[model samples]
Target chain A: MTPKMNSVGVIGLGSMGYGVATSCIAAGLETYGSDIRPEVCARLIAEGAADASTSPAAFAGRLDAVILLVVSAAQCEEALFGEDGLAPKLRPGVPVVISATIAPADSRRLGARLAGMGLPMLDAPVSGGSIKAGKGQLTVMAAGAPETFDAVAPLLDAMAEKVYRTGTQIGDGAMVKTVHQLLAGVHIAVAAEAMALAARAGIPLELMYDVVTHSAGNSWMFADRMQHVLDGDYTPRSAVDIFVKDLGLVNATGDSLSFPLPLARKAYELFAKASEQGFGKLDDSAVIMNYVGSELPGTRDN
Target chain B: MTPKMNSVGVIGLGSMGYGVATSCIAAGLETYGSDIRPEVCARLIAEGAADASTSPAAFAGRLDAVILLVVSAAQCEEALFGEDGLAPKLRPGVPVVISATIAPADSRRLGARLAGMGLPMLDAPVSGGSIKAGKGQLTVMAAGAPETFDAVAPLLDAMAEKVYRTGTQIGDGAMVKTVHQLLAGVHIAVAAEAMALAARAGIPLELMYDVVTHSAGNSWMFADRMQHVLDGDYTPRSAVDIFVKDLGLVNATGDSLSFPLPLARKAYELFAKASEQGFGKLDDSAVIMNYVGSELPGTRDN
Candidate 1:
């Protein structure tokens, strides 16, 4: 079936955004890419994006839908309503699908602001790292008005393998995503903790990894991230600071609700410490260094 | 080819133990059962065990191998060395495979004690819970001398679907199990923390569960234990104090090595608090009560 939205604009062409833009191109959508990095925009254009427009406003009016894949809610706001904001140039009723991991409250506020301008907003936060994003196999936890979801179904389909309609309330997607990040962040931290203890006890990290992946102890993060620990490669498929940021959002939401999330708080602290120790730019699995000190399993120091 | 060992003695017939005993019987072994509870011992006999002796000494000499599925290290030592102890009555070279979760140090100590009596021991802690145990599909993380493992191969094959030889060291299995518990315990607690946050935000617990199970946030424990949260069924499939004990073991190991496991420690505290608040006998998912208070998702209070 031909998708209704034939042309798409994807802002913030970082690792995730770049993948989304390329996937849209692969899905036969005329994709426009924007990023703070002009070189990345150029690279996306070379990779089959129809245009590498650094200014979203330049082609915003022609786009059928816009996807915001920036890092933070503030950036989501700035990109859409800032000095060179694209929302102002877009035609009314053009659905804006925000796939950034933002707070539900922020998402609700953004949806309200866009509604005031006659635009529809769907809070569609995504999971699965850039690898899946590049494969167009991301899982999108989305919530918005039914028509808004229908409007962006094709764009969502282009970038995601599974798109869950959380509810018609815009913030439901963000709330689910926040809870998801809570699990993802804690699982990574606990995987690191488990591995460090295994390493300290003189069990081979590879054997521990094999046993865990096959056992009830396994998690998607444990299977995926612990490989980096085994290989001693910290190339930052997802960096430490990302969880530091995401778990911080989790805690912020908990705080706003006067609810306590101790595990999330602890995981956030672990990531924050990893960031503080100069491992922030390293892979999230490098959080093991917080427990193992300088002697990582596959590293030269060991 | 027939297994090297044909007759087996299984001690402790609680949920996990009863399943293991039945699985051994199903494998065509002459399984003997021993439990403090006379009724459970009789029950195992009804399920085709060759004998159900309350006193291990009564059958220890005839068994080709013995499997201990008791609760703790002290109980393990008591079962083998206390009045009516089985070790003294067993023939030399009768491998004793201990499937109870215990500290590595305790396992090593038991290995030393058993070696003094010409008894070989395998530290073989199990996972997959009671259901898998009944299906004979549990994962066994075992460590012992190669000869000892070979001696009990048939019995291990009968009880476990996957048997990982962690190493030749007696304590290695315990270490791996401890590490596994570190992951499992933390995952359950974090699952509770995440679900609580979702419930607090008014997201349907069922939808959050579905989204997580399908996303990167998924873990074996979250998928298994959170169902209790959704059903509001606090039935003790695995109780809160089990993690209180397991994560306590995790932290004790951490303390011994001078390693810090902040996530495990936080999860342990959550479980301990749950236990303290009278949820200890409930399923481990009841840890969510620590976060959501009395208003659990499917409970009448909600």
Candidate 2:
């Protein structure tokens, strides 16, 4: 079905946001892009995105739907409902799709504020990483009022392979997303630990990677990120800082809700220590090296 | 090529052993089968396996090759080099393949013992679980003498998708399998902790599973086993004791090697706690419900 919602605004043009904006245009949405960085905004405009104001409010009155691709719950609140927010600029019944992975309480509060402003807010958090975002194959966890889902359906389809209607409550999407982060973080940590242990035991890291990939020990994290270890390239596809944000959201929600998450908490501690080791800007997989310490089985030659 | 090595003896007629024995027979070998249980031997005999003595030695002298599929390293050692053992009974050169997942040092010791008897021993551990075993699509990690590889080629073809040759040393396969266990155990633990957090936080477990399975949080473990959680049926396909054994292997190797293995140790602790809590025979997925006394979500209805 053709998307009835035409004008699309994707805020926060970071790696994920840029990929999403590219997908929006590729999917034939009349896409507008903005970010905190002027260079990024100019690049998006050069790539055929409409040169839009950084303010989420700029597309409000004209847009049938707006997608908040910003980082953190605070940014989402500010962009949608804080001073000079999009909620005040939108038509009475327009839809707002919040796509940041955030705490459930933040989603519920922001969604309630938008609803009070006569805006239909869909609490949507996306998955599948940046590559999938660029391909428009992202999975979205979303919950909203009935009309909100229908109103934003077009934009959701243009950008996602699946949209889970988790519950009627706004926080359900963010809650599920938090759960996703918990597993993702833990799996990455475990993959690093296993790889390091193997390497320390005198198994060549490259051979260990190959053997483990074919064995039962394999995980998506190992499959996707082990190459970085073999090559000794810690270049950031997903930065270590990303986990700092993700695990923070996890611990925050876990603490507030009293959820028992000791393993997840322990994994976050490792990632935090790795970040503190000055690997924060590198890829998250670099955390393996931190755990392994010196005397690494040298990386593959470039 | 058709196997020139005609007479092949397969010990241990359990799931994996039966599958390997069937594959050997299909490959045109004169296959003999033996297990502790007489009923299993009777079943193998009815299925075309030649009736064999409970003696690994009897088959050792008659057969070109012998495959040991016992449960533990001790059982493998007992079957191969016990006082009344196949190593002494073999005609000084018949190759023996050990296909049980075991400790590397144990495999090394067994290899040394076999060498003294002038018999070649291949430390060959397998993956792909029981169902894959039945289909002969298992992964085989093998290490031993070069001639041993030549002798085992026909039987290997009958039972594996891939054969990873670690090195010309018996402990190679066990070392690689230990690496596999580390990854597998951690993945299961991560899945358990994530799913439990979701349940405790009031997110629907089915929806949580679906979203995480499709997202970056996904691993082979989550995709394969979360359904049992959704179905609330924890029947032991791969029992809890399996992880207790596998993770213990991982930690044992890591500790002996002085490798820092926080995640591997944590994984073993979780499985050990679950086994202690009485889910010992349930599917390994039952480890997800092990945070019992902490009183977060308690246990799901399954």
Candidate 3:
């Protein structure tokens, strides 16, 4: 099995990153975690992680794959091969696996530059949310050369339930993630519209949600996310701002392909308005509050 | 129990209508069947249905209810109180249970006109579809006076697992049905969009559909319906024209309230386009053909 390169480096210990890093350690990798946040680095080290230096200077030959789990395409670029980037100091043969949800163009362009430097790249964006990630039940859509897959096969099997090899091209993984987020965003928006209509109709909100959920009228987004509106729980599982980024990715990608995504464009407007109305940090379902114009039905602080 | 009036008439003998009429007969009511097509009437007669024409005229005093399970609002109107309508011919106390999918305002107006004839009217639109109807497992949304619910309680119990007494106003049940259709129509559209994007990106669509149904992207619509697409079998469990009608109900209600249902509106437009493309008779999942521009991925037939 080519000696199983077992050491892995994970950058950005935010929600998704922390889950991935923990799952890596849980999967018995010598996992190293780095973040701009010192407390995150300390916490990971405290949790059986190999002590990691945030500076890329300490990583010349230890990692088989440096997984980027940051936020934006810009953040990914900054973390990878920036002035203090991982690309310059990391060992040449190890692959850089981009796990962040990002634009396909960014993945393809960066993959090309990395290929020129003799480092293989795997564009892998994950699903199943953070909780599943910590349990190593993530769905990873990965696209790269088959050689890149062969190099990191052991780590992938440990960290994910399924590793979908979309194509040899680097952008395909990001493309699938874009498609997933598009439905996710639209489903939530439609659920919101349904709920808002019920709310205006003066039907008991919870009863409406319960009946709709059990009936043919239900959607995955409605069943999972509408409870936030019913319980008035605006806690940020996946925040309102996440869709802002994801839908922007959709708009960008749709423009590139000349596809008219009216639903995606409309959903983006709603979420953008919700984010602008000071709910950028609340759970994505809180986008429903954009319509009701008040606190949700039953939420109260204990 | 207003003497448990023995005779009842059920108009229309499509799948849903036939099931309701048979359920009434199984409950020991002398149920009458009527349809524009004489063949449907002949089939119902073989199944122990009295012909509606003779039964309504000869047993007007004992007819307990005229259950209209016609497909649309227009058909329900035509049979119930239209020019040669049953409302004027039936003796006063019998209820007219409208199980058709229709607009609330239309149901409200019909209720008023039926009430003027001294007849109780229950706007009871059903869910759980035709199979559930045959099994008496549908959920009924019934709204009218207490006497109307009392009069129809046995029949409701026989036909449904749950009967929601939404309000003592006939329009409430229709309102709930409209809202239910709103969520259903939009969810199917989102599912099609998500699946289409995955198929184009070359993720074996069955795999993507399976994973997403298990993941955050799931809804009742996806779980119940996407299999038809994955199996490449569009056998019209619920037809595309059904959504066109349901979403029209959504827009009609939304317009009355001046609510901007952008997501649902766009979803309706897509289904409308699909219907215009000669797929109106196929399963609603065939809406994917609008995006995929062909029959379902593995299907031999359109």
Estimated TM-score for each candidate: 0.96, 0.93, 0.93
Give TM-scores of the second chain, every candidate. 0.97, 0.93, 0.94
Tens digit of lDDT per residue, candidate 1, span B48-75?
Answer: 9899978877788889999999999989
Candidate 2: lDDT of A287? 76
Number of the predicted model whose lDDT against the real structure is largest: 1
Candidate 1 per-residue lDDT over residues A1-302, each given as its tens digit: 22478899999888899889889999999999899888998899899988887787778888999999999999999999999998889987899999999988899999999999999998999998888889899999999988888888889889999988899998999999999999999999999999888888899888999999988899999999999988899999999999998998898899999999888888898999989989999999998888888777688544
Candidate 3 chain B weakest lDDT stretch, 10 residues:
B52-61
If the candidates were sorted by their DockQ against the true structure, best first, what order would they fall in? 1, 2, 3
What docking grade applies to model 2? medium
TM-score of chain A of each: 0.96, 0.93, 0.96
lDDT of 3 at A202: 67
Q: Which of the two, 1 or 2, has more DockQ?
A: 1
Give the share of true interchain contacts found in each model: 0.96, 0.75, 0.64
Winning model by TM-score:
1
Q: Give model 2's TM-score versus the native structure.
A: 0.93
Write down the lDDT of every candidate, Cα atoms only.
0.90, 0.80, 0.82
